[model samples]
Target: MKPKTPRISAVDLFCGVGGLTHGLVRSGVDVRAGIDLDPSCRYPYEANNSAVFVERDVNEVTPAEIKSYVGGRKGYSLLAGCAPCQPFSTYSQSGRSKKRGLDWQLVSKFGELVSQVQPDLVTMENVPQLQDHEVFEQFLGNLHGYSVSASVVECIKIGVPQSRKRLVVIASKLGALEIEAVGKKGNSVRTVRQEIADLPPIAAGEKHADDPLHAASSLSEVNMKRIRASKPGGTWRDWDPELLAACHRKTTGATYPSVYGRMEWDAPAPTITTQCFGYGNGRFGHPEQDRAISLREAAMLQTFPRDYKFLADDETVTFSRLGRLIGNAVPVRLGEVIGEILVEHVRKAEKGTLRPISEELSGRLF
Candidate 1:
């Protein structure tokens, strides 16, 4: 008879609405707890996963505190952190300083906790642009004792219904590690229609009577006219001349064509951002609707489960808060891929079939 596989446990930092935790749990990892600075995340994170939520900033969390949650587990320990990406995002590049910024420092802090706790596995997800920063190098340096591999993964390749890209890093102290490739273009790619077309329709400035969370924000008279003229796969260029914003007429703003656009039903969505509920932000307008994609639709594009609840019965939904939580989450599909990779690595190691870094470097590890 085969021996039972040893259980793997995890502690998620900056867990944010528990997207990573949800995916990991689905992939068979026993996630004990999640740590985050946002109190708003407590409800959703705790509600959806088996883990407890610790509402504390990553910077303020000590190794002892982290150990309290993960220490008693009997098997492999994993630490996962998806630090905020805004500091290294292309949109914020011009203003970022060489000196460590707050978000960058959070990545460094993640390294600190990893060094102290010395978990069997470590994984991090962040903007692809973070690969260019010095802090990333330092974080890599801190993992010298472990075998590490990283890649910039496209979200759509991993079954997410959006064209988002993220930098993913995985390291293992037990043996060499390799993350499976995802986001291959072909019949496997998920589309906007497949992700959200089934929802009962709701008009602009309205909420579904049965599901209040399936609500869209109100649009002003002028903006409503602009959305009416927008086309799927087309930009503001399709709008009537009078409906164009003044900034769009200028040469500088002419480059920002994705704003005031609509998603193509047959293709993946543009990257969902914190402002996705606004018609003027990216190509967030529903393909056939007269308003921006609803908050529920935005979460769906991020690969969150359709019934994933962000608010409670008595809690009022606010566009800004929920939008940020949803957009900032790691796509649950990508998290599953990560969890699968780690589990595979451990399985191979136990069976004595795992390849060393030197042998696997050329074939895997981007």
Candidate 2:
């Protein structure tokens, strides 16, 4: 008889648009359900993956509810959480005021759930800066008996077509756990051209007749002129001095050269943000088009499948809403990395081939 398939059931906390769920499912994990507070995510999270979408805050969810999602599952239980990362993101840190209040507490709450649920395995992905915060220490403290391994993963090195870095953590109650490595054996980093060049071009403010999310946001005449002069991988400095924004004329604004820039076709795209749909946001302008990258292109940079559905048949495509959803999502490709590791971690544990927890955490970060 063929060897039995490894049994792994997962419940995703703060699942945005099912990025993590889709990745996990793609890697052969049985993702049971996704929990999030956003009603807008309900359609996509459930539609793309074979998982129920629980429309509720992570804080409101009890261990019992999470257990029910994994009820009667056989081999291993996994709890995945990618809490709202804004609080720990570098952008939020560089702003005038520090991001705090309820969002900060959410990390604590994620720790609390891990302590309460005590699943066989746990995974979390977040901004790299989070590892520096005290909350991260508290989160580690909650894992009394688990061996944990965390590293700052370079997205491009992991087969993602974007220049992004994220903190990925895996903890297991059984023996030692390690994320299976990839992308080191002549695996070339994917590029913007590789991911989105095939997409039919659309003008600024125009939506594709066939794909609603392919629409680009409209630009003001001044912004249009600026984009027309912008070159791939070039910044607003490429424009005539007369075309410069009032702020760009100042020394402080000169330091923010990434704004109003165009992405290079051969390189990985800049980190996608909530305002990526706007021409003025980051280096979001298309390589040669006089328009910002559309909602669909932004999603593709985040490693969302081309056909990934973000809206229902009757729903209208709103730029701000969809941009927030797409930008805030954890890259689906990274999620697959997380899933592949956990599956192998389980397989090794069952065969008694894993190391002890004490030996594994010595050099965890990569």
Candidate 3:
């Protein structure tokens, strides 16, 4: 009989609520553990994934600690980091990031860990804006012996129901590795109508009898009037002068028209943000409902399983905390795509059939 193939193992860094870990498991990789600093994430990450949740800052995590998670039995070792993107996000360009004390060197720390651990495979996902920074180039410099492929990927093209653009980088010591192309030709883009159209409808401030996450935030009397007059896919520009906010009346605020709008039923949702639960935050209002999209709908748009657990039996469900967790999660489908590519890369390497990316292009960021 042919010998059994050795198992593939992985450790997820900055794994918020196990979005990436769950998707990697779904694609057949054994993710041993997920590490994040937020204690609130512990219940959801461990409850939803087979992996253990480690609450520690990534800067303090040593190579030995990462290896200990998987023990002695592993054919391939993957170190995956979807570092918090707020530091490199386009939203930060307005100078508010300075006040948040955001750590810009975390990506460099991730690279330093990779150099120390020297895992067989490494993958990273972040906002597309990260691709332009010198830190990303320095991260690439750390992988001295790996063939690397990096690109900006559209989440909807990979079956995610939101219009999120993320930078994905794959590196391998075994041989060349490229993210597998998916959602071509016959595969239709996932739409908002397909994801949340069937849910039991609830009005503003109402929670479903059985599901707490289905609750919507309460709208004020004036905001209720504004929403009632809002049309799907239409911005605050479509509203009457009486319904417009004082800020919207100013020349500066006129540029920010995407807010106070409703999502279209037939199209994919705009990128989910931490403030997505608030109707005034973005075009987050429900297509037909007279309220903003519920927490459950946001998670579904992020490609999480409809029944995925986010809290324990005794935990209280708060919109602010849950919204941040759900919004910050890596879309699960994109994680699955990375897993598929990694699995195939290993398979080809074992057969000595893996192709190497050209040296000229390997160092270039797409």
Against the true structure, candidate 2 reaches a TM-score of: 0.95
Name the better of 1 and 2 by lDDT.
2
Model 2: per-residue Cα lDDT over 1-366, one tens digit each: 845458899999999899899999888899999999999999988889889999998889999999998856777899997988776666555542455657768888988988998999999999888899898999888888999888898888878888899998888988876544433324479999999999998999999989998999999999999999999998888889989999898889979999999999999999988889998979999999889999999999999999999989899889999999999898999898788778777878989998888777455534
Q: What is the TM-score of each predicted model, taking all chains together?
A: 0.94, 0.95, 0.93
- For 151-236, candidate 1 gives per-residue lDDT tens digits of 88777766888988889999988866644333222337899999999998888999888777788999999998988888899988
| Best-first order by TM-score | 2, 1, 3
lDDT of 1 at 355: 67
lDDT of each: 0.85, 0.87, 0.85
Candidate 2 minimal-lDDT segment of 10 residues: 178-187
How far is 236's C-alpha from truth in model 3 (Å)? 0.9
Which candidate ranks first by TM-score, i.e. highest?
Answer: 2
